[model samples]
Target: MSDDSSMLLDGLPVAFADGQTIMEAAMAAGIFIPHLCHHPDFKPQGSCKLCTVKANGRYVSACTLPAKDGMEVENNSPDLNDKRRTMLQMLFVEGNHFCPSCEKSGNCMLQALAYELEMLSPHFPEFYPDRPVDASHPEVLLEFNRCILCELCVRASRDVDGKNIFALSGRGITKHLIVNAESGRLADTDFSLADQAAHVCPVGVILEKRHGFAVPIGSRRYDVEPIGMQVERPATAGTPGTRDEQA
Candidate 1:
């Protein structure tokens, strides 16, 4: 695929390859588009809807939508941000995200994006689902309460680690992450700390047993910089504060 195509991301021109998705092009050009399930390392799962943007008048998931030449995309608009903020609030309320007490506080992508999107509160009523915690694994801990259904761990486990340790069950709001074992425990499965699944969780769901608070609050990944800056992108000459751009 040739890398000669170009598109307008919020009026700024972004060059893309023939097969590159809008998200890929934007990121390559150092344009931050907020997302959770569409990691660059994994297949683009458009389940999280967080990367939805207006492309040529219609809304589409930037991570899944292929970039076209001369396409006009609106990313940081007020309406789009408003919708994203609502989604963030719902995600917060859907799970028991006690960010202060959680081990993934400063390093969590969800938490960082919430702050970036200016999510002041979990606007809707909280679900507070009584999910189980799996401490049966010798080296890893599984907190179901923090699962955002992003399926990053599932992908990592199946595709990268080839362990198939994780899967999702149920439907709609009842859908949840489940261990791929008859015993329904992490210990029953071959989930190792070395597996990509152990480190791919954007939230506090899949965690190590004793590594809590190893990094201080102010020095964690997102603590040092925002989530938008977590991924390395090509630096543009004029955009001095591209990292601080509206994500």
Candidate 2:
């Protein structure tokens, strides 16, 4: 019924409240919309454009667009998936994301999303941009090579942690994460391992030092179960994060 305050997501009815976005409603209704740069705690940012969906004949970011009653939302279509795949390919080529050598191989959202979408190969040529690794912090490693410019850490530090430790510099392809200190190092700032910014990253850009390979191969977060099945669906029984928290 139209009075039920529901929207048609991929032809299925999904109930949503007044303030909930399509992504939020879909997640709550057990529907998956591929997204990055979107955390439940932070305001919606449409930077990644991975969750683009055709709603009422127009394309919009599912993460930011509010779900209206009776609206038709096309999330899992070939055209939408193709666009998402192309964007993922650009992201892969623009950064130096060697998944095998990275610490967040299985747990990383980017890697997991790519796998879920069945992104066979990075279509474009790799940019291989020279980004520096900031190991100034004792417990953290800032590997800029794998950064997707999601700005999750930036928001977490500024909005949540009140530290304002991270920021984005430059424009277009030159843009990258920068520390807000005079020394331009993480150690110079008041950032710590316990900060919310440390754990908000969905990629391998920010990692805890000395904790690499702590979970071991084939037993990582997404290694056993896919990210969609893990995060989108509630843990049924005997799940790691479901029974006990991770990190």
Candidate 3:
């Protein structure tokens, strides 16, 4: 497939490649689109509706929808923006996302997206779900209370790391955390400290040991700007300031 085929997104003519998804094409064309589960290195799960776009007047997940020639895609329309904001709000209230206490406050994707949409407060009431925190691992912690269940970590663990240590256990609002193979803690599971899932989390739910509170909130990565702004930058160059030796 050619890398420069013409397509129409939101009534605007744009160039797209045949293999790229709608989100990839729109982002390559400098269009700002919101999404939660669409990581560049992982397969598209299309679980999050935050990146929904109108293609030929039908709503579809931009992360999974391929950009075909002559397709009309709407990305930043007012209605879509509202829906994205609302979905973010639901995520905010569904978990224990207390920005004041979280170490990943500034670097968190969910927090950054909320700020991008100017979500000053959660419109929905808090779910206050009581979930257990898994800190049994020597180098990782899993705080189920703060999880938004975007599933990026799951995919990273399963597909990228070849470790099926993480999986969604329940259904709907009653959903809770579950370990792989058995009901043991992450430490007992097949999860290794080197798994890509350890770093793909969008929230503080999955934290690295000896790394929490390493950087102050004001000095964190997303403090400079929204994550969308850094998406196009080189990963190393765009990373937030870290106290680690690698930084």
> Can you give the TM-score per candidate against the true fold?
0.92, 0.93, 0.89
Model 3 whole-model lDDT (C-alpha atoms): 0.77
What is candidate 2's lDDT per residue for 1-247, written digit by digit as tens?
2447999998998898888999999999877788888888789999999999999999999999988988999998889988998999999999999988888877777888889888999999989999989999988899999889999889989988899999999999899989999999999988886687887788888788888777776787778888777645332123345211131
Model 3 agreement with the true structure over 1-247: per-residue lDDT tens digits: 6666767887888888768898888777777677777777777788878999898999999999888988888887788888888999999898888888887788777888988877778899988888889889888888888888888777877887888788887899987657785556888877775666767777777777888777766877778666667655223212463422111
**Order by TM-score, highest first:** 2, 1, 3
Angstrom error of the Cα, residue 160, model 1: value is 1.1
Location of the lowest summed lDDT over 10 successive residues in candidate 3: 238-247
lDDT of each: 0.84, 0.84, 0.77
Residue 220 accuracy (lDDT) in model 2: 76
- Residue runs of model 1 more than 4 Å from their true location after superposition: 1-3, 233-247
State model 2's lDDT: 0.84
Question: Which model, 1 or 3, shows the larger lDDT?
Answer: 1
Off by over 4 Å in 2: 1-3, 232-247
Q: Write the per-residue lDDT of candidate 1 for residues 1-247, one digit (tens) a residue.
A: 4567799999998999888999999888888899888777787989889999999999999999999999999999999999999998889988889999998888777899998998898989999988989999998889999999999889988998999999999998899999999999888987787776777687898777777777777877678887777565322223343211211
User: Which ranges in model 3 have alpha carbons more than 4 Å from their true place?
Assistant: 1-3, 233-247
